[model samples]
Target chain A: MLVHAGNSRGAMRGERLCPAEVKRGLLDGNPWQADPSLANLSGVADALAGNGPAHRIIIDATASGEVADYHAHWLEQGIHVVTACKLGSGTTLERWRAINDAVARGNARYGDSATVGAGLPLLRNIRDLQAGGDTIHSIAGVLSGSLAWLFNHYDGQQPFSQLVLQAKDAGYTEPDPREDLSGDDVRRKILILARAAGVPLASDEVAVDSLLELAADGASADAGLEALDAPMAERFEAASAAGAQLGFIARLQDGRARVGLERLDATHPLAGGAGTDNRVAIWSDRYCDQPLVIQGPGAGAGVTAAGLLDDALRIARSTPD
Target chain B: MLVHAGNSRGAMRGERLCPAEVKRGLLDGNPWQADPSLANLSGVADALAGNGPAHRIIIDATASGEVADYHAHWLEQGIHVVTACKLGSGTTLERWRAINDAVARGNARYGDSATVGAGLPLLRNIRDLQAGGDTIHSIAGVLSGSLAWLFNHYDGQQPFSQLVLQAKDAGYTEPDPREDLSGDDVRRKILILARAAGVPLASDEVAVDSLLELAADGASADAGLEALDAPMAERFEAASAAGAQLGFIARLQDGRARVGLERLDATHPLAGGAGTDNRVAIWSDRYCDQPLVIQGPGAGAGVTAAGLLDDALRIARSTPD
Candidate 1:
């Protein structure tokens, strides 16, 4: 079933959307009931209270960090959550702790496998390795799909601005391209990885070096591009001349995290990727010398949805019949 | 508590080996009890039958294929099985089906993640991706740590025989080094990977190319090396002249599986590992163009034990308290 609390255009407010109605809104495939009155969290909870326990709950929306507290509340109520929401787990360490604590107390699961790398097996691998008594030393990667797309296409042949515009058109960038350019998304992803690797890192601890130097408040895609082109062009030129490629690299090492544009040699592990692929290299005691690498499509509606569904299946299969 | 069914040397034919005894057998880290009466499957089963349901049972022994039926029996008795034994899952398709059927019938989990790649997360990733609706295309890798060591060190500078001897001395190769050279281990692993990718592949379906031309049966490390040097030398010369390196490559693609020595370019994903590191590249619909890469130490007592313990922990944590 599709239950929407709100929409970008503010159209879903106070409406309990059924699976069929949601499908119709998304180009009609299956018919589902529409509950116009089941709009917000409390309404959804009330609706759920009328039914047996859910197999699992899937959250796949933008900036889902706003519902971080609600996620904790749900976990405390013994409900499993499978989310693609970075905000909830990628927020401050304090909130991350609360959510984890609630999960433990309620014996419920919080599946954020889709939060980073579009449901890549990175987090689960880290957790498993740790449980096996391996200590993680560091993690580094090209985490942002939009940024990866931008860098992979931003050769000296094309103006960086053109590549940014193309990425936005390809649905690889955020609505405001500056969000991709600013490097905040990459920071959030790194934070998520660090936490999964057993690091209690806060969002503010990451030293982010955003591409856009101008004020980012209320900027549109074109406006963000205009502000970012000059600086990015310079970086591309310098990197190209030095026989290197530009990669928006995020690193979590020695209890410190940072994200920025870095020039990586052609032979560098993270230097290879076309389009919107997210590549990550994890370094732990067992994998310390040569990091275990995971690379794949980091973003896209289909892949993200698949990741969320994967988490749901894991929970369902684990739960007793 | 350690339960001993049998020992290769007939030393523990009917003994219950405690943790301290096992440690002492490994050069005395701690002392353990040695009960010689628990010598066979029926005895172990009888002991287990007297107890309540176990959360999990771990099988960490050589030639564990002999116990494939026993593992299925345990799983049918409501016991989860975590195995370092590839034989249970890598056996003939008929036996494989029976074990899987038992797992489903008993609603018991089978932790075969430790069987291949030393619990490198390869199998689980493939399973999860398939469940997530992604179609896997192919999986290729250098899966054997002993062979990987031999190849990485077998530059034309050193005779291949000497490298094999060194590997055996370093505890990298099987006691019967012919077992490592016969390509049987790699074939079994490829079969496991293909099955994990949802292919109902039979063991005989794979067209395996063994490294040794002469008979390897009952051959010691020295004897196998003597028989292997000529063919291996020819390969090294041809590959070296072509600026390529030799690796024992296992590939599952296009509904066919093969394992043998292959000449890989310098930049091949599996060619970068050093020492006993095993590297794998997985291709799928979502990651079709750029295969997901995973590299790490594929063999070692510490890492393998860690993998087994990791599987045990997974089954334990998933079981209700």
Candidate 2:
């Protein structure tokens, strides 16, 4: 069932009913085929013919929200759809409503296992604690690994070059590391965490100060890390000597959410942090007393690959689809 | 539909499953249905037969392993069971298989949301981040607020009793903080985090070292605290000059987990972490250039309560029924 489709794109088109195709798909274990295609939503709808061997359809979208729009066509097929949208889970309550309606209409299960996109598994953790009626006093941690690394080199004016290079050397930066340096990366992550924490929020609500100096020219994703590096090294050196390390943090309290982007001096608790680690802690209520905390590494190939493997195993062990 | 039966143990068994009773249960929206009025598991099963009305179920066990046996029955139904008997999420792959099977066969979802008991949400965050292939590189943190608190107070030949009391006053210890000081609580939480990060582990595999000193009789959960109070004061009085602090750290790496119970001196980054504050960090491979770090207030009702509320809201917003 493992089809080597040659790496360009692995997609799940909406139940574009092609019994023969489905047979091939299921046989190929191209589970993505059961999902709606990104292009031409109507085309995918028209293709779905009838119930095929695929009962579960998981849409692993570039942005988890993409698959959310196809609840209608998916419901009639009775094929459950699980998504890992990058946006906050609540952003599309309207779409989720469609899902709830689809469930009511005898469709399939709809879940967003990947809404927050990697690192600390915030949503899942909150759900587990809630089952026990545990009180949560606060949730605090480093939400962005990229920003932390970017700031690590900021000695007020190291030109941010040496830092970016160091981050690159350390593998903290991505092939395109700017995304990691930009405040956007951690901001979205913490938003996902906050949403799971049950904090009603919009991404804008969390303040973000970029870890990398912005390019005046304003290049897009295509610019990659080039724009990020060429600038800022000159301005970041001063902060590094006094022993200030960069770390991005997200915090939640009574009806409020805040992001902490600061320089941690040698005395600061986080100053000694090594690289690209993110932590989310919940001040838990209910057990004996004082809040309970959970902390850990926030990013990497091994962990993420294992996480997906866990999801795949979970799916395999679940419905047998 | 709110059933106004007498709130007694006997009433649980005698409870009728009439339309009125169903209405009451629906109106209350409680997730658990417990009492002695039923003949067998079928009675509990029958009570749960209503269609489409969303609800919450909380199963609180009196002791170890009691809840798991009962839950195996619930697993046959569509209930998404969360329990402590399975303990932390990282119990075993074999256990994970059973739970996953139940979730699949029951056409349900299963998560040990409260696996770490009072600790903050761990699995939820990992689950939510499953979409974009974000990875977890390393996990290390000060897991026990109470232990951290106790460590803060100890300077000399501090009996654990005085320190526990000091933690209690500082809002670091719970009503009974012995669970934390004993190391079991922190170990369980670390297991949960490890599993969420996709490690297949068991709590027994973790090496735990208790920081509690043996009292006149023994270091029990209750009496131990009383004996602990005296030396703690002197420890704090003595340490204040040296500018040191006590902290409890839980770490998971290379499939192994351990804890550090220490008195960090002045010059140590973790020194002087006041009150219930906790700091956690991770070293990730994705950001190979640097290790990521996260730190924050690791204890308190306000923070924990917020975490609980977050879990409740995530459930309300998603598929936690």
Task: Identify the candidate with maximal TM-score.
Answer: 1
Q: Which stretches of candidate 2 lie over 4 Å from their true place?
A: A1-51, A56-119, A126-143, A153-158, A166-182, A186-245, A248-273, A281-302, A305-321, B1-119, B122-145, B153-162, B168-321
Candidate 2 accuracy as lDDT: 0.52
- DockQ scores for all predicted structures: 0.40, 0.12
Estimate TM-scores for all models: 0.82, 0.54
Quote model 2's TM-score: 0.54
lDDT of 2 by residue, B1-321 (tens): 112121223223233346455435434543354343542333444544565336433232223443444554566566544443334234444555566567668545544544543324444544434433456665766766666555645555655665566667666655666666678778767776777677767667888866565344575666666665664555456556667554677878887888755556653434444445554554444433443333445555444444444444444455644
Superposed by TM-score, candidate 2 places the C-alpha of residue A77 at a distance from the truth, in angstroms, of 6.9
In candidate 1, position B99 carries an lDDT of: 81
- What docking class should model 1 receive? acceptable
Per-model B-chain TM-score: 0.87, 0.64
Model 1 fnat value: 0.49
The native-contact fractions of the candidates, in order shown, are 0.49, 0.12
